[model samples]
Target chain A: MIQFSNYDIISNLLFATQWTILLSLAAFIGGTSVALLLTAMRLTRNPAMQTVVRIYVELFQGTPLLMQMFLCFFGLSMLGYEISAWSAAILSLTCFTSAFLVEIWRGCIDTLPKGQWEACRCLGLSFLQTLRHIILPQAIRVATAPTVGFSVQVIKGTALASVIGFVELTKVGTMLNNATFEPFKVFTLVALIYFALCYPLSLYSKHLEKKFNVSR
Target chain B: MSLVNLHQVHKYYGDLHVLKGIDLDIKAGEVVSIIGKSGSGKSTLLRCINGLEEYQQGGITVDGNEVTTEDIQVRRLALSVGMIFQNFNLFPHMTVGENIMLAPTIVLKKSKAEAEEIARAMLLKVGLEEKFDSYPEKLSGGQQQRVAIARALAMSPKVLLCDEITSALDPELVGEVLKVLEQLAKEGMTLVLVTHEMNFARDVGSKVVFMHQGKVWEEGDSKTLLSDPQTDELKQFIGAVL
Candidate 1:
């Protein structure tokens, strides 16, 4: 049996935690970009475009996250594609995050009164102009808190990438427990690290919700 | 030629017809008020003229352009017709100044300085010049509605449609908004209003149209029509309202 000193385990887990942070960032930034495109397509009022986006959202949201990671990690390999575990983890998490975000943003846009749209129309502002100037500016208020809150989910979801042999914090914790025979210590440390990362985000989101509510 | 014209116009929401066959004309520089009971289609008819609602039959033209639901055409038609909604509909996120400047800079394609210049002028006209930096939510309802008028006027439209612009204000606040509209009417800006204020309509309006069940129930000068109704609907309406 391998003897992992306490210092060895802590250093190894902390090093692996960087990957968790990096993976979460990759998923969030990519997920946000794609969500924006899908939201624009859905709001275009074109039936075909709206239908395509609706299907994409439902497909990702309805399935389990683990199943999606498995498909991206293994299914892509079987198809003769050379995707790395990092790429597969990012791909699955981005699709998962974007699906939820599109709905969150659309809800923000929907809460605006129909009169604002009519007023835009009457002002001779083109659809794009209205969206840029009036609609999005207002939607940003309601969208901020929810979007920040959803980031917490993305951080936790990166732990699932360990199943595909991605070397993130959770994966390292498992490895350390096997070597040190310290599952309680390793896993508890893992949980605390995640809480440390996500708790500030949760608090910021609550702060923003109250700030916007006051202005509203 | 009339500045605004609607001929045999009809609109339907599902199976329920809202605006039945109707014909109307308003000459240049006319202040016309549309009034009736709730669901009389006064607001719907005004909305159709501004291309906010599509009519299934007949046509509406403003400043020699036919209004249609074609995206580009409606946008083009909107250039000439500015509308004030009942709820003010000001962009709540922006300052009063930014709200007025948005359309002109974007839709009118004016330079920021020019749009700002005109926006300031419109605010001055609405008597809210000091509110240039204030956000919409910070203003009173009447102030917000006046800012909405300034927002619409920044486009320098050929016609202004007021869709019950004062309906949402407190009873005490109604006068301030009405005063701005009165000033606009005095300036020979063509105004179309859907209103519940019979006294203001009769006093300022060159023409008063009473709509009932989606048709022009009565049309005439305000004095004769309000004092002596040609139709029983107008008489009963005046009785119930006044």
Candidate 2:
């Protein structure tokens, strides 16, 4: 076993947090793009398009994220493409994030009264105009709290990428623990770092929930 | 020729026939009030006129243009017919000024300054000129209903359809909204209303229609219809509400 100084372990974990942040951001931005498309499809009058989005959502949501990561990591290898751990992690996490986000935003859209649609329709606004000017502005208020809350899940979910050899915060923690044989010290620090990132988001979400409670 | 006409219009909600063979005509400057008990299809008839509720059979024509299921045609018809709902479905996120400006700017393609000017004028018309920047949730039910009226009028519709606009307001606040409508009727805006205020119907309606079992059970001049009992249903309805 190699002996590492306390400063060395601390510096290494902090450095690894950069990868965790980058992965989380990529997953969030990409997931939201795909989720918007899914939401639009879900709202369509076409039964076939709606069914396609529904199956896609259920496929990602019904299966475990860990299993999805494995398929992207290993399944692509079987197809003769050289996939990097970073790309696989991003792909799998994006799918997982989108499934949850589509459902979250769809619930937000449904919360709007049916009369809103009728009112806009009677005003001679087109469907896209109604969504842009009327429906989405109202839905964003209902969606915001839960969306920020869900982002905390995305940040923590990046830790699972370590299992597939991605060098994120958790992977760095494991490596340090293996080298120094200090599981308790290393994992407690990892948990603290995660708490540092997530707790503020949870608080902010609650703050927003109170601020946008316009129904009352 | 009638400005608004419905010929044997029939509407259904799956197996339930809400509007069965409704025939009506309103000329320019006519104030027609539709009155009935709950489930008597009075509101449904008003909705059908605006194409808010689709009829399964027959036709609705406004200004000689037949209302159809086509989006473009409905939109064109919407430019001529404005509707006010019971719940005052103002865009909650918008200020009263913005609510009035939206349709004019987006649908009519009016310039921002033009829309704002129209909004200000309409707000003044509704006696809520000071509420230009206030959100709908900040206003009382009566104030919101008046804002809804201003929003509808901002479109410059030839005909205005109001569905139980005062039923959702407090008894004291109902008169404030009706006062605005009465003012509009005096100005010669063609108005169709489904209402529960028996007094307003008797006093202000140029034509009062009594709906029962999905048909026009009785209709005549408001003063004549309310004073003379032509049917048992009309007498019972008037008795219960009056």
Candidate 3:
């Protein structure tokens, strides 16, 4: 049985936690923008636009993220793209995150009643004007909770990037565990770090939802 | 020239026919009440006038622009033809002032300050000045309906259509909405109303049109139609209700 000092293992895990947060943030921002576009397209009446959005959502939702990561990391490099693990991880996570975010936002939009549409129409506000002023303001109340809660999923999802040789917290912990042959101790620290990042965000989301519901 | 005209308007809901060849004309400063049993096409006729509902076959000109062909033009025409719905359809998120000011600011291009002033005056006109900052849910049923009337009047519509505006309210609350309508009619705002209140039909309406089975059975001066002997259908209807 191999063994290592406690300080060595704990320090290595602590150092990699920062990279996990950074990777999560990059994936989150990239995903949210794409999701906004997908959701808008989903709401459109144009058949072609809706079809494209539906295909995009289905494509991402249908495939496993592990397969997507493998394709992003290995397949692109084979095609002479010369992508880094960081870029591959970001791309895969962004696509995966977008599909779910689009669905969450669409649910928020659906919660609005049909009468709101008629009320805006009779007031002579153009479609965009009505969306910007009337619909979106109300939708924001609903979208806030799920959006923040989804951030936890994003953070957890970044751990999968470790399989592609991305040096996030999980990857670093795996490397440390291999050097010291202490899987239980190293993985425990990694799990705690992930908890630290996600738990606060989860609480904040719940708080926001309760506050908004009461105000409404 | 009449402020509003509809010639042989017919609206169909798939296989269910709603408005069957409705012909109507309203002159300036006229207050016409349409009374009928439920499902008698009273609300559909009002909705068609405001361009809220489309008719399959007919000509509808409100102040002269054809509404059936273009929704945008109908919207433009709707600027001068305001409507009040049975449910009061107010924007629940916005304040009473914001609800009244939205159309003027967006559609009429009025400045925010100008819109606010118009909104304030309108709310005062409807006896809702104190509730300007309140949301629709915060207000009572009568107050919300009054705010809806104020919102419609803020557009400076030449013709106003009230589609069972008081039906959703409590018996006591109904008076507050009708009182506001009475004041608007008194001030010479051309109005068309779909109402169940027989007293309102007899007192405030200069002309009464009784609709039965999607057609106007009889139409004449309010006093003549309500008091004097008429068709058997009218006799039975009045007998059943009274």
Ranking by DockQ: 1, 2, 3
For residue A7, what is the lDDT in candidate 2? 86
Kindly list the per-residue Cα lDDT of model 1 for residues B94-140, writing each as its tens digit. 89999999888888889999999999999999999999999988899
> lDDT tens string, model 1, A105-184?
99999999998888888888888888888888889889999999999999999999999999999999998887778799
lDDT of 2 by residue, A103-191 (tens): 99999999899999888878888878888999989898899999999999999999999999999999999999988889999999888
RMSD of 1: 1.4
lDDT of 1 at A151: 100
lDDT of each: 0.92, 0.92, 0.87
Top candidate, metric TM-score: 1
The per-residue C-alpha lDDT of model 1 at residue B112 equals 92
DockQ values, each candidate: 0.78, 0.72, 0.47
Stretches of candidate 3 exceeding 4 Å from the true structure: A1-4, A74-82, B69-71, B216-218, B228-236
- The order by descending lDDT is 1, 2, 3
lDDT per residue for candidate 3 within B161-194, as digits (tens), equals 8888888898999998889999998999999999
Model 1, CA-based lDDT = 0.92
Count of backbone collisions within predicted model 1? 0
